[model samples]
Target: MPVESIHGRGATRNATPTRFNLQERMAEGDWLDQVEALDGVSSRRTSVTIEKPKSILTRNSSPDIGFDRSINAYRGCEHGCIYCFARPTHAYHDLSPGVDFESRLFVKPDAAKLLHSALSRPGYECAPIAMGTNTDPYQPIEETWQVTRSVIEVLLETRHPFTITTKSNRVLRELDLLVPAAKLGIASVAISVTSLDPKISRTMEPRAPSGRKRIEAIRLLNEAGVPCHVAIAPVVPQITDHELEHIVEAAVEAKAAGAFYLPVRLPHEVAPLFRAWLDEHFPDRAAKVMATIQSLRGGRDNDPNFFSRMRGQGPWADLLRTRFEKAVKRYGLRQTRFPLRRDLFTPPEGAQMRLF
Candidate 1:
């Protein structure tokens, strides 16, 4: 049986259903049908329709996070990182936080324009507008949609401070804009490098670029005078922890100005998804990994408490911290945060309003 795609409805038959009611229901939008059918029973290949959202700035005040506002050009990432904390966000849109989270992606075509409008609004504050805090802004679709690039242009023109977090070298494509922004102290970038091992990276981040490429991205950004940082984030215990020092060393070699790390967070549906991935990839070591994770999570899959969530708890967590401190010192990685300037911010030039 050639299952073309995963149907959102109850069992979708690829071999033409015998039931007329099923076909009618599918046609009526009661279910989703992939537009393209592949020969193999792989993940669904559906046409991605664009949704022009009304607004783009997402404000937050979580003590665990650094930024006050963030923007995501796309909902649901193609990277398919099993440990993504953003997975639960898809559920708010009435979509499954699992397979649907990766397959059914939405692009905000109006993101750049909306961001510009938001920033230009009177009384708008000039805090760093975080990008890729949810789904990556430089994901594969960026090549076609160009929403992230346009948003960068808007930020650059207005001298707005912004920070980007991505695992793709595709960001290098926007160096022309980034270089100018960096010179003005209006921009910085952090590359998320999970594991140095390609095999582990493939399973951990599925469709994301290779770990080596991300290192190269950091180097390129630094060379262009853009402040580059390496985020050894969601550090999976027992699995990727050992590579923390190695990753930091590599980042140092690549000329990353600063470095940061976060213990793996398995909030919401991520816990089970991570477990499943572990079982599939490292069954023998699955128990040990979960045990260590639970220890960090205070005997739970996750600890939602403010500060503790960013960094974890227990002996393993302390060890990771010590390791990070040692590596940063050893590699001469800066502990100082990349502080974006607020004084440089200028409202978009236009005669649109004069209420101020």
Candidate 2:
């Protein structure tokens, strides 16, 4: 069965059965019948589920990543970026890393409360807590749930240092909190702009804000006294790679503090899903794109090593790095890491009382 692109969605299929044995019934007679019934229909309404976890902060020791602690307000991202490395996470819930990862969503409503409790612990250590490390913190459902906003409120009240990375312009919604946090040198933001072309953005990140909107967001954030940067994450070869210099120039024009990028990565189930997406959207050069990506990943679909995963190893990777370095230098955009202050961190009122 050929995978056909769904309208307003990035993944062409609902279940990818091979990787994790998730949704293995797709080949069943009854399942095929059901799938056939919904072949051309594209109206996939998003469904939200509330999840109450005991804790909200996640601690990781990944050597490549900058931060040690992070918060993910939502489990499945509605942005529906076909190449999202986080999509495989949905398989843990017996859901498909394909369409289900975007449509069937889970939100941690108690995130703020849990974060407060964690911060109030007797031995709690203050570090920059990262948001949007896995799934986007400002994904569409955030408008109603406001979980991410609530988490930010807790962080602000406690005077904890934090950072946010998102592809949505929706981060501006919490400017009231962000502006104050930024003034204290405790907060910063990074907006991802994968491609300047609207057509490519629509198909690649179907539900994410357009590249134009993201660029405008960087401008607005910087003007508001917030240290903002541009992330050209997962620069798809044979697709959006041509716009590298153009994106860097745009970031400079927006007064971005710095800019960075990563070559496309396809880890776990994302590889097949991305392949299907390629066949659906860019059938013309899909093969070339994969070849380039494999070259960057050392002939594998993905490079899972520590430092190498962040920066690919090969001529293609070297070329991307050289181009990015020259562009940032030529455009005068600083490549320096955004400095966040941790000295100002203060325990929440409850924690302070407990100390006394």
Candidate 3:
């Protein structure tokens, strides 16, 4: 079957008022002042459509990122985190990076096969393959598609090294595979926990596993002997920044081996999307939030300049770094600078190892 068939093709649109507009998936209706009027349409659950990806592995060579290559089992994420940097990726598929990014999802059933072929090639190099860097591999559709599981299966079978980053506790479902990989020093997991507040998490990352659940997942993974860490990432300045220490303390309590933190980044189309979300959710504090963000981002929406982008510049950035350092020191969180061994990698049958 063609890749398009494996990933569900675009649906034929019908002029039905009840049907959701997939193209504008994130557009929220007017705040309904009355409750009774929402009864007719509020109960309907949207049907998921699958889309097959032609290939899975995506490569990048940047000084800041640790991994050189990564794979995403799905195109758009259903997690619908308003602060997701990967949100803008949906625009490439002719969808809005906002609502369409969260609702009009795509799954690549062929991910395992494509990864196998890629790794089976003569030119293939052994590097930690990062998942969930762009989209959550274990999002809701994972229950049905199982593409992430299959991909992990391929990695485990070949004794391949990989790392996963995700916001879902669903990754616990694959501990059977990951635990073994960890034993071989071929795998590690990072759970992205944005905040401990349930109310904040509900609006910020609507469809992702709750923050508490993710912390529980970290504890579970660590108990199972899979190296796990908490990624206190994309720290929204005035919003979730205050919770940094709280997040680290919780992660350490949950037995996370180490912790890392990064400031909120709004590159490309993510800038506008983030602004819109801030406007919608925290209208009262939107300006203050953006102002704080600009304080770190060199007085702009984002800093796209290499080293500066990841860490940011100026006093606010320095303050955050200092705060993070102090928190990690107090919490005794482990360091993720744990390097994976690449010498054990062997080329697939009949393929020569890459010289590079």
Candidate 4:
């Protein structure tokens, strides 16, 4: 995602269409022509739409990510974290990845049905499924669609293993399923916390739950026997970077099983969006911040290389890594990952079961 605007949203900004739509996963951009406002001037409100996808399961063998298959219940995230690497994906829909990425959202209502169909295949292989890999599965719209919960119901019913990550405490709504799944060695959750500073969090993640709320969610999840960990993501250099140790400390206090951090990544549009954010919030240190980030990213806004993308390089990266390692050691937190059981998977198709 290339930078769209410093304005609020990761909001639906009207921008030129992107150059590629490889598999033709494209849609015409919509406009309301109704009244909305930005910069104290009028603008149009972004609209949400329902989309029916032909399939939901996405397979990625990238070494950087832990899972091979994943499902995203929603296309755009309302939690509008400006530095979201996934935001640029909205451009494929011929819309602005900026505002549209946040204001405009799309939900897959048939996610559960789709999953059932895929799992019913004769040679279907069972593996830990990752949810919210592209966008937060438990975003605000899930409040109404309940699509995420619907998908989880299918996973639980079929005895499938899955993991979900989110910054929203809304996850608790489905704890009934998560708790039992964990008991069966089939579920894990990671709550990403950027900063404990209320002011920084509110500005950077306008719609996400407060850091306090997310940490509490971890504490509660840990109590329920679910493996909950903390991800201090997009560690903004010179700004939120200082809170790296504090976030891990808080996660430990909340009984988080593990903690990790990823340096800010500005794949495409996110670079400019993040730059704008720094200029607005940390004007005095904006230049220094980007400089430090570039130094860590091989003198570029981002380093898309495989292993290094997750594990950064350079002096600043080394420092953050060292800090994270010491903090994890201090908290007695070994790798916080829990392997879900693939053997437990059961096909939902009655015909297959009847044949057995």
The model with the greater TM-score, 2 or 3, is 2
For this target, which candidate reaches the highest lDDT against the unseen true structure? 2
Steric overlap count per candidate: 0, 0, 6, 11
Ranking by lDDT: 2, 1, 4, 3
Q: Give per-residue lDDT, candidate 2, residue 347.
A: 74
lDDT by residue for model 4 over 125-171, one digit each (tens)? 88989997889998888888998888888888888999888999999
The lDDT of model 1 is 0.81
Predicted structure with the largest TM-score when compared to the true one? 2
Question: Which model, 2 or 4, shows the larger TM-score?
Answer: 2
In model 3, what is the error at residue 322, expressed in angstroms? 0.4
RMSD of each: 5.8, 3.6, 7.9, 4.4
Question: What lDDT does each candidate get?
Answer: 0.81, 0.87, 0.78, 0.81
Q: Find the number of clashing residue pairs for candidate 2.
A: 0
3 versus 4: better TM-score goes to = 4
Tell me the tens digit of each residue's lDDT in model 2 across 190-216. Answer: 999999898998898999999999999
Give me candidate 1's TM-score against the actual structure.
0.89
Candidate 1's residue-wise lDDT over 285-343, tens digit each?
Answer: 99999999999989999999999998889998899999999999988898638688999
Ranking of all predicted structures according to TM-score, beginning with the best and ending with the worst: 2, 4, 1, 3
For model 3, residues 1-356, the per-residue Cα lDDT tens digits are 11111011111111112123345332332234124234443321223556666667898999899988999888777777777788666666656665556666777777777787788877777888999898888888899889899988888877789999999999999989999889889899999998999888877887788899999999999999998999998789889999998999999999998888889998766777677677767899999999988988999998888988888889989998898889988889866665666766765553422220
